[model samples]
Target: MRLTWIHPEDLIGHELRQARQDGRAVEAIARRWHDAGGHDAPPMAGASPEPAPERLRRLAEDLLDELATIPSPLADREPTGLDAVISACPDWPGAPLAAPGPDLAGRLRGAWAGRAAGCVLGKPVEKIPREGIRAIAEATGNWPIRGWFTARGLPDDVAERWPWNRRSAPTSLAENIDGTPEDDDLNFPMLALALLERYGTGFGTDDVAQMWLDELPAGRIFTAERVALRNLLVGLASPETAVYRNPFREWIGALIRADVYGWVNPGDPARAAVLAHRDAALSHTANGVYGAMFAAALAAMSLTANGPEEVLAGALRVVPPESRLAVAVREAADLARAEGDFERVLDALHARHADLHWVHSVNNAAAVAAALVHGAGDFSASVTSVVSAGWDTDSDGATVGSVAGGLLGADGIPDQWTAPLHNRVASTLTGFNGATFDTLAARTHALVQETSG
Candidate 1:
C-alpha cells in the first residue's frame, strides 16, 4: 500500500537504513531492487507497465515489517540520577541553585502566555525553507530576529520569493497581529489539562487516544498522531498504533503536547515525565516518546529551577541515560558552550542532523538546547533564536516559550511579546473556546494545588 504522506523512495530508503542500524543484512533487498531497475516505481501505467519494479518495492515494504517484528536492542547504560543521564557524561558542571518561591499562579500564567506568544511568532514561518526564513526576516529588518516579524517594507520580489505560511501569515506577522490564533500546540495543552482533570495521573494511553477521538478533529492532527488516530479507527492498540505504518514516530508531535503535564507537576520532573510518557505512548515510541518526557520534565523543573542551565539538567534527568535524544541534547548544550557563537551552533546542528528528516527529534531537540544555552534564560532571546534558527519553527518556539515562561513567570515576560497576544487564545478543544492565558493559568494552578499539595 502507498503512504499518502511519504514518497515511496523515502520509505524504501528509511527502512533500509533501519535495517542497517539493526545489523540486519539488506543484501537480498538491495540486490533485488538493483536487479529490478533501481528505486523508481515505473511511472508509466499503460500496457507493459513495469510490474517487476512494483513487485520489488512491495518486497521491500514487506521486509520492513519482518524487520520491525524482531527486537534489536542497544547496549547502553540506564539512567540513575539527574546528572549525566546518558553516557554517564557526568552531571552538568555546575552547582545547584535554590528552588524558586511558591508563586504557582504567576508561573502557570507565564507558561501559557509565553507558549501563545511564541507559537504566533513562529506560525508564519512554519514551513519556510531555512534560508528563506532568514532572507525574509533580513529583508524585513528582522535579522537576528529581535521581535515578531513584519511583512512591511519588503521588495515585491523578495516577498514573492519567500512568502509567509499562507495559513498563518495574515495574523502572525507583526503588522497584522491580533489575538492568539488556534494552534495544535496550545490545543494539546488544553486537552492534557482536560485529561488530568478527569483521570488525574492515573490516565493511560487509551485515555489520551480517546480524548483525541472525542474532542480533536481528524484534520487537526499530523504525522505520528494522524497515523495513530487512523490506527485507532481500525481497532489497533496503543503501542501498536505508534508503529503501524508510522514513519514519523520519532518526529516532534508528542513533544509539542507535553507542557501541561509538566505545568501540573511543578518541581517534580520525574513524575512529570511519567505523565508525559502515558500521553506520548498513544502515538510515539523511543526518542519520540523521550522528547515529550524531556520537555515535560524541563517545564516542571523550570517552574522552580533557578535558571535555564539548571532546568536543562533536570530535563536531561528525566529521560534514559542511554537514549539518542539525551545524547543529542547534551551534545547540543556542550556545543553551545564550546562554540559561543549562535550562528555556528545552528550550522553545526544542521550538519550533524542533516541525514534525518526535517522534523526529526534529534536535531530539533538540539536546536531547543542551543536556544536555551544561547538565550541564557532571556524570554525574547530564546524564543526568537529558536524560531529564527528554523527547523520546526512553531514547535520550537512553543517549547522554548513554555520552558522560559515557567522560569520567568507571567510578570517576568516582556510586555512586547505578551501584549500582542492580547491576553486571548483560541483552541479546538471542547469547553476551551476563546480562552485567556490568565484563565488557563488559574485553572492549572488550582489543579496543582489540589493534586500536588
Candidate 2:
C-alpha cells in the first residue's frame, strides 16, 4: 500500500511542478522522470496509489536532491529569510504596541468561535471544486451557504456527483456536528497556543519542532508537515526538514497555523509576522513562509483596524512586494474591489490562478484576500465566500473567520453562525480535545497581556 505523502516517487513528481513554478531549469529532470516511466502526482488530497518499484524510488531520491540545488530564478525577489523578506518590502511597518479594543475578551471569543464555525462549515466540502459546491448547495436549497452544510436534503444525483469529504461528512455536516470537529486547520492553532504557553513569545523553530513531536500525532499531519516530520524522525533539523524532499513546501499548511501568533500579538503585525515566520520555517519556504506572515499580520490588524480594507493593507506590508504570494493577494484584492458580484470576482480569480495548485499558498491566499475584501466585514459573507472559492476550503474559511471574528467581536457575528459551534472545539492534539472556545480565548487573552506587559 502507498503512504500518501512520503513516498519518494510521489514526492519527486510534485517537486518537479514546484521547480517549474519557481523558474528552475528542470527540463532535463522532467525528461529523466518521464523516460523512467514515473508519473506526475495527483492533484487531490490524501491520494494513495500503489508504490513504484525500488529502483524508481531510488532514482526519485537522486532527482529530488538535484532539483533542490538548482536555485529558483525568482529567488532574489522571494527571499526566505525574515530579514531579507522585510528588506524587500519597502512599506515594512515596524511592530505596533498592543492596542486591543475595549471588548478584547469578547473579540477573542468571537475569533476562536468563528474559526471553528467556518472550519466546520467548509469541512464537508473540503476537496469539492467550486462548481461542485454550487451544485451541491443549490440542490439542497443552500446556494449562498449562510449556514452549516447538510447532507440531509442533498439530492441523490448531486451527492454522487460531488460526494462529501469522507472523514468530514461523519462529524461536520449540519445534522452531525456536536461541536467543532477535528481538522488540521484547528489543530495547528491549538499547537500554537501550547507553544506560547510553554516557551513564551520567544519560541524558536526548534521549539515548534519539539512541540509537534510531543503533542501532534504523526498520522494527523499531512503534506509539507508530514514530510517535515519524516525528516525530523531521521534526525534532521528544521530549515533542512522543510526543504529536504518536501515538494509541498509552498502549500497551505503553514498558513493554517498562523492565527494564534496574531492573536498573541494583537495590533502588532510585524511582531506577529516574525513569530509566524519562525514557526513556518519548520515546514515551508518563500511563498509558504510569506503566507503564514500574511495570515498572522491579517489577524493582528483585525484586532484594531476599522475595516477589511485597512486590515488587508496593513497585512500586506509584511510580505515582500515582488513575491508571487504578494502579487496574487494584491491582484485578488483589486479584483474584489472592482467587481461587485462575488461570482464574477471568483471567475476572474480562478482564471488568473489556473496554473497554481488548488492548495498552493498563492491561490488560496488570493482566495482568502478576495473573500475578506469582498465580504466587507460581514462574518458570514467572508467565511462563505472563501469557502466557496473551493481551494483548501476549511483552511481559508478558518482564516477568514478568525479575521472577521476579531474585527466584528462576538456579539457582531450572527447567532446562526456561532450557535452551532456549541462553544467547544475538538482536536487530536493533547489537552485540546473537547476544549471550549471560551477557555481557549481566555488563555489567548492572557498571553496578549503577558506579551504586552
Which numbered prediction scores highest in lDDT against the true structure?
A: 2
Compare the candidates by TM-score and give the number of the best one.
2
TM-score of each prediction: 0.87, 0.98
Candidate 1 lDDT, tens digit per residue, 1-453? 333333343345555554454456666776665676555322211112232366655775675576566554542443322232333434332322334466877988999999988888899998776788889888888898888888888788988888788888888988888889888888999999998888877888899988988999877777778878888999999889887766667778999999988888888777787788888888877778888888898888888987899889888876775677888898899988888788888888888877666666777888999899888889999999899877889989999999899889999999999998889887777889888999898888878877756
Regions of model 1 farther than 4 Å from truth? 1-64, 73-100
How many residue pairs in model 2 have overlapping backbones?
0
- Report clash pairs, candidate 2: none
lDDT of 1 at 115: 90
User: What is the lDDT for 340 in model 2?
Assistant: 93
